[model samples]
Target: MPSPRPFSRYEFLIAWRYLRARRAEGGVSTMTWISLIGIALGVAALIATLAVRAGFRAEFVDTILGANAHASVYLSATSFTNELTGEVYTQSGRIEDYTDMAARLAAVPGVIRTAPVVKGQVMATAGDRANVAEVFGVTPQDFARIPRIVDPETSVGEIDAFPDGIAIGSGIARELGVVIGDRIRLISPQGAQTAFGTTPRVNAYPVTYIFSAGRYDIDRTRIYMPLPEAQSYFNREDVADEVEVYVEDPENIAALTLPLMEAGGDRALIWTWQDSSGSFLRALDIEDDVMFVILSVLVLIATMNITSGLIMLVKNKGRDIGILRTMGLTEGAVMRVFFLCGAFTGVIGTLAGVALGVVFALNVDHVMSAVNMISGGGAWDPSVRGIYELPARLRGIDIARAVGLSLTLSFLVTIFPARRAARMNPVEALRYE
Candidate 1:
């Protein structure tokens, strides 16, 4: 058997000549340019869309971790399950000695900070309206260290100034028609076991602060109060519901979890942010995957254009191929000649698309702003997304995938036409001449 010869420059020269052929000389037609542009646009659009999805996912992760800790140490004694609701009542983790355990956990290698908290559900009422919300009891100082508790519009303020002060989300403030310095009633469903056993236990607190957490659900349903005051109100004096833990590096939170569990003891239940936000993040992942498949269909359609152009080229160049075959060029070389013509378009288009996509992705926020300005519309409305600007980020892996898929499709589409051109009988191809 003979080894295959090295690729000859003659093959590339023929391919280039065929691509640049004028209509008079049976060269490339207008359709070739159209197909090339179609592929370029499709690739560019896919890259931009993927970048935006990636950026949004990152933003969401940061937002969630900003308000919540990396991990939490729950001190629950026992948990109950409601068969009907499928809700497990873990009923806040209680620690007998929060201070000692928190201090110990703080000294852990990866742990950055520890905060003890009390959590429950309570009804808040001011004026004639009342709404049920999640109440968190945390010291103002510790709460401030939790990343996003303070924004330009709001702050926890000084709870020490007013021992009985209350801090609520901005949405709660609107719903209850209350403001800072106004009194709102807090009703706990866990009533004291008295003569009227398990009625609602109610108390009034002055609103001292308002926080806007940038999440529609959390901003509307969250309430914050002093930890000591909450302990007294809930009859859990000197005890905390659980200890929330923050780590030095959120990406490597697992390093702190095992040590936290050891410090928290065998009975303690520790949960990470992943556990709490698992379903939500998974849904986002699924959406990204769906978008990728849908966008890739555009490239598929563009490849069809390549197929059409190559088929036309084969029909027009039948005589040329016959002559080339007669000149001692193998059938394989004939096929390669046509394949390179189509592959050239694919390669150039893919490169151009990559450059276009990266530029668009990096400047997506700016582009949106420009569009909004020109249209005189609030396209980047913060109220709609709780974000001032649309997000976008480029990843090398995404570009590689897009380019690979484009080139693969381009290469495959040419085989049918290239093979058809190669298989023509030299006699029949030249018989009419």
Candidate 2:
């Protein structure tokens, strides 16, 4: 007779029979179930954690690049001579030819646009409520280009009339008890210079637009005004503090540093977004690595259940193995049978975990809402977390990694037990019976 093929039908049949045996008949059904559940839970946790990490990072970066400049060009300090006293003194940096500077910066390759901005801090008052706000003086056209402010889904009110009025963040509007068409007063410490000294400049502008940048601090404090109005209120006259540069690709902004410098001349001092947020990004990367290591250990601990379950199955089936070996089964056939049993449990558990993880990631927003409702609506604090809502984004590579880790562990732990069953002495196994 021809020798049976490797992992023949009989091996699978015997493996299934052993797996389906009743618990009362020395079966390891309970242990198998425990192992399966452990592996499933572990894999699910890994997938969910990775998805959330990815989503959080993406959301953070999006808000930064969408609402703010990818880079800024500031003029360096220059020596100025007093016309009356004839004394030379150093003056603070200010871009006098900002319009021309913006035009030149916009012409650089990979640059999308450049806007001259005058920034200042002022106290905003609407009725009895008052709060400190950071004001940005930008042209109506430049303000319209901001992704977050221009997105109709997240912003409300008319932006075409932005030059006629001012735009305020939703959080600021709420705190000051103001709405669209309401007027808010802005008080600047640096006002018109008089013979004696300077007086505070106070001006009121109607709110024409309300926007949410998806960041708590930004939404609570940022205000945008017409460029001319801002210059007048901030005492900047025809000068701008800096020129904000928007590029096609923010990630590779360093590559354009030389070109941008050449465009802005020797007095240009460029500051990229990375200079402000690189530390936070590095912290996030470190956290991701640590989290993966911790979750990997959890997965390993869960896979240990497989080892215990298989060892128990080997011991319980000693008598059966003796009979099968004596009847004509080879050692390799016995090993293959037990190996199939372990492999089946792992494959099924991993598949179930993947399904569970994907579903959870897809519906993370709904899950958070429900959780917040149950906890009386303070579960996620944007002020503390830097984001309004929790995010989850699933990647194919992350899922594949989780599944691979689980299945590899499951298969590896099954080997020793399967080998033990195969090497059992037929005479010794039947001696006890």
For each candidate, what TM-score against the reference? 0.80, 0.94
For candidate 1, report its TM-score. 0.80
Q: What TM-score does candidate 2 get on C-alpha atoms?
A: 0.94
lDDT tens digits by residue: candidate 2, 225-244: 99999988898999999999
What lDDT does each candidate get?
A: 0.82, 0.91
- Residue-level lDDT of model 1, residues 235-308, one tens digit each, is 77899888888887987776667888889877777889888887878998999899889878999898778788
Scored by lDDT, the top model is: 2
- List where candidate 2 sits over 4 angstroms from the true fold: 1-5, 25-27, 79-86
